[model samples]
Target: MTGKLDAAFGFHETALRLRSERQGVLASNIANADTPNYKARDFDFARALQQATGSADPAAAAATPAPALARTAPAHIATGAAGTLVAGNAPLLYRTGTQGGVDGNSVDMEVERNAFTDNAVRYEASVTLINTQIKNMLTAIQG
Candidate 1:
């Protein structure tokens, strides 16, 4: 029962964390939109989520060759190439701009904003699902 509960919530928990991390990455791009030579970086959310949930594609992971960081202590800061990856410490990829900036800044406000907003919605959904799962587990235990 304990194992099943853990397995059930694992994907949602990882998704929540990854989505939160992606939000920050997108926000950073938006924040640095004006900074010269600020190359925008982001990861494929679907790929990241798949990796975090231990559903990574071996071919993809092998091609990328991610460097992972393990947090053994509670006080250890999260690895921020996007918060120390879970299934693998996949590196962030640079975003290609539709309209290049004169100053070599890669961030496009519209794209960044859209991605940020979309990630927020997905994050909230993951949180809601997790909460529902917890509630169901509690009810089952109580019964």
Candidate 2:
């Protein structure tokens, strides 16, 4: 079934998705560094990927405890924990710059640059791993 395919491919797919999402979040933060009252947002890559791939059945939780068919809406929909989404993992607070800017933006250029670099490195590493896995799979199939 589709669930099985998701479970099998989830690792690579989830990592790629998280990497892309993180890039967007980081870029946004960097772009808004000078904007007043702009709070940075990011995703918890590890937690989100774990949650997405950990379950055997992607929709199992949602399907369970079925409600009445006639009900307009279910009282509660199965939801992942808070801060588990792509943008909930951003640092809640950043230290105000010693030489604070008049705009009240606290994003330090050096810090954001370092963080972005590190994320890029990690993303590359994940891509390498996935590529190696694919190559190995191909070799096995050919043999």
Candidate 3:
């Protein structure tokens, strides 16, 4: 039954999880906009989703390689580009070409705001897709 549901929902489930994880990274970037030397970080959604869903496409797999980060100590937590615990295998890339602040902070409010809004929209879409699939499955079961 678990496998049946997994097959039914397909990649949207993984996409929803990745989107939620990315929201945390984006939110952390916005929250630390003023923190000195704080570099804004984000992952390629398409690439992450492909990897998470275990795509066999070589081109997509090579497009974005997930770099493994090692924890120096057991108590040390894995931190994202913004020093937040963004748990996932998605590669966190630093935002480039943005004007760095005099204090060395790399977060641009405009960019962060735009990314956050975009991610939120995508997340909602994923949730809606999953809900639709569930409703269709329930209807089939009843009928």
Candidate 4:
């Protein structure tokens, strides 16, 4: 039964989790826009999702070793390969600056805003999908 449920909701479950995590990263980028030397960080959602779903070719996966996000402190969460969470490590990639600032901050308000909004919409959509699936399951059980 648990396996069946996992199979039913696996994709959306992973997607929703990744979306929420990405939302946090985007928010952090926005919050640190004014901070000097702050590099905007993000991850490849499609690639992460692909990795999480175990659909990637083994050769490709082996070729790319998981890279860690730059951490300011020793206690920060360690990031690694996409879609595989090992002790809170999420794969984070630094965003390249479109326009360099005097203070060396890489965050662009326009880009962050757009990405934030898009991630939020996708998150909401994932929630809606999960809800619909649950409702359908309940209806079937009742019938």
Candidate 5:
């Protein structure tokens, strides 16, 4: 039915939006690698998708609190501080490197490269899934 197609389209739309936003965040972190005091940021894709899709709890929307603002400076950087301060359901935050750099920048080249690659693969998968869904719908209508 057309309604099924519509539902599939909605899911694809949401997936695309999420993927685009994630790509933007990753690209921003890569771009700011050289900037002093710039902290890397990322989001938890699974948790965010669950929240967005209303899968975890229908009432979560009403109970969820606003994302905390990123602190420009603090008296001291403590362990686990970043865990609590994500900007949104994103679950993304600035990561502190195990090995500190002279400039206080913590962007690890290898880690970022891996993350970028993984994200790209996931994005491609999402696109492929959407395409298949569309193809299925078209076949159904044609038949």
Candidate 6:
């Protein structure tokens, strides 16, 4: 039962976490907008979410000779491939500057603000879905 719940909620939980992480990066970019030589950092949410959900690398999986063994730990999800990128550790890509700045700060206020707002909406959606799932589970167990 616990494992089932974990599997069901895993994607949402990971999404919430990754969204928060991305928000932090965006916020950092906003906060340092005036700082000289500050480079804006961000990641691809789609790739991060796919990785978090233990999405198989189709190419790698197809070429594999044998299936991966199940992991023993509850938190040890995924044997996707030799180099599966984790959500928590997704590589950060520097945001390209739209206009030349004398201070060399790549933190664009408009871009960071837009990204932050988008992330916040997605984060809220993920939280709402998680809550709904929990409520449904509780109703099932109680009745």
Number of the top lDDT candidate: 4
Q: What TM-score goes with each of the models? A: 0.78, 0.62, 0.78, 0.83, 0.73, 0.76
Regions of candidate 3 where Cα sits further than 4 Å from its true position: 56-88
Give one digit per residue, the lDDT tens place, for model 3 in 55-110: 74778556855555667798987654424223345567888835869999999999
Q: Is candidate 3 or candidate 5 better by lDDT?
A: 3
108-129 per-residue lDDT for model 4 (tens digits): 9999999999999989988998
Which scores higher on TM-score, 5 or 6? 6
Residues 1-143 of candidate 6: C-alpha lDDT, one tens digit per residue: 78987889877888888998888889989999999999888887886676567684758535633333566788986666323333643456788888857999988788889889988998988888888988998899899
Q: lDDT scores for all predictions?
A: 0.80, 0.63, 0.78, 0.83, 0.71, 0.77
Q: Rank the candidates by lDDT, best first.
A: 4, 1, 3, 6, 5, 2
Name the top TM-score candidate.
Answer: 4
Instruction: Enumerate residue pairs that collide in model 4.
Output: none
Query: Which residue segments of model 5 deviate by more than 4 Å?
Result: 1-3, 57-64, 67-88
How do the residues 1-143 of candidate 5 rate in per-residue lDDT, one tens digit apiece? 67976775876676677777878878878888888877777777776677666575657655755454455579645535233423225456676675766787787767777788888888999899888977987898899
lDDT of 5 at 136: 88
Model 6, CA-based lDDT: 0.77
Q: Which scores greater on lDDT, model 2 or model 6?
A: 6
Clashing pairs in 2: none
After superposition, the stretches of candidate 2 with alpha carbons farther than 4 Å from their true spots are 1-6, 55-84, 87-100
The worst-scoring run of ten residues by lDDT in candidate 4 lies at 81-90
After superposition of all CA atoms, the RMSD between model 3 and the true structure is 3.9
